[model samples]
Target: MDHMLRRQIEKIVPLTDSEFDHVLSFFVKKKYRKHQFVIQQGDPVNYEYFVVSGLLKSYILDESGKMYIMQFAMEDWWFSDYTAYLNGAVANSFADCLEDSELLGITKENKDKLCREMHKIEHFFRVKSNYGYVALQRRIFSLLCNDTQKKYNELFELYPSLFQRVPKALLAAYIGVSRETLSRLSISSGRKTQED
Candidate 1:
């Protein structure tokens, strides 16, 4: 677990053994079973979780009871209701385990202390946040301007593993398409892949 965390941080910034130990001191490990909710809407969001293994999906349900998948996080990904975690607000979204999952969680207070104590850790988080922002922007642009096929193809390219790990119906929700439409897209994409 420590090795996984170290590897993730080292991708953005190198850390000395002491520094890594200090960083790890701020996190607590936990496990959840499939279908368990890591967080529920309207709850006080206390921790941001770093996935050690398995998968989770963050989503929201509208007043009409339609569910929208906002994001999926698998191994090596960090996930939370960022606004709520940062501002002490109640969560407006839900995070649930898609599979049995292992996670390392850090509270905002501890994370702030870690960042304040280590410049490199602060830089690593800033870079990660920037990357996360760019990804969200890309997703928004694709949703607004891309056709169904393009959206499906782009999602497949970006997270090919998701197609295998996530249910087709949920994938459709993430792409803002009907399951039938996703089926058609899948068949077409398979054919295109074979041709290539």
Candidate 2:
């Protein structure tokens, strides 16, 4: 499992054998069933998760009890409540599995230790954060500028697996549309194809 995770990390940076071993040594395997909490509201997040398989989502519930999706992590994604992890404060967000999941967890303590022992590990995280930061920025722009039709196409185009793997309501939520609107969009797509 660590071998595969190491390979995933290698997509961004090459790790020497010694560095790989050092990084691998810190990972702890964790599993969760669908709907199981990986982190709960008001709980401190000690671990950052690297997803090997299955889907997990981080969201926050408003006082009215409506959930706002922050992110969805599937294979090869990393997620944690950074505010909770960095400050050692309680989390306002909750992370839960959407399907049975396999994850590699590394605690903030071990990560700090790794940063001290291995510079490459620190660099990898720095680089990874920049990528996630960029993605969040792009997502913000897409939400701000894209039309519903464009958003619908972009989702299918970018993450084809999402159509099959995630539920329709969740996809609708992510796209900032009602379920009926999404259903109509799907039908609209099919009609255009038929006309073509």
Query: Could you say which candidate leads in TM-score?
Result: 1
Q: What would you estimate as the lDDT of candidate 1?
A: 0.91
State the displacement of the C-alpha of residue 107, model 1, in Å, after optimal TM-score superposition. Answer: 0.8
| Clash count for each candidate, listed in order shown | 0, 0
The per-residue C-alpha lDDT of model 1 at residue 194 equals 19
Put down candidate 1 lDDT per residue, 1-196, tens digits, no spaces.
6799999899999989988998999999999999999999999999999999999999999999888999999999999999899999999999999899999999999999989989999999999999999999999999999999999989988998888888888888899988889888888777221110
* Residue 140 shift from truth in candidate 1, angstroms: 1.1
Regions of candidate 2 where Cα sits further than 4 Å from its true position:
191-196
Mark the 10 consecutive residues where model 1 has the least summed lDDT: 187-196
Residues 140-189, candidate 2: write the lDDT tens digits.
88899999888889778877776777777777777878877877897888
Candidate 1: count of backbone clashes, pairs at least 3 residues apart or interchain:
0
C-alpha RMSD of each candidate structure in angstroms: 3.3, 3.9
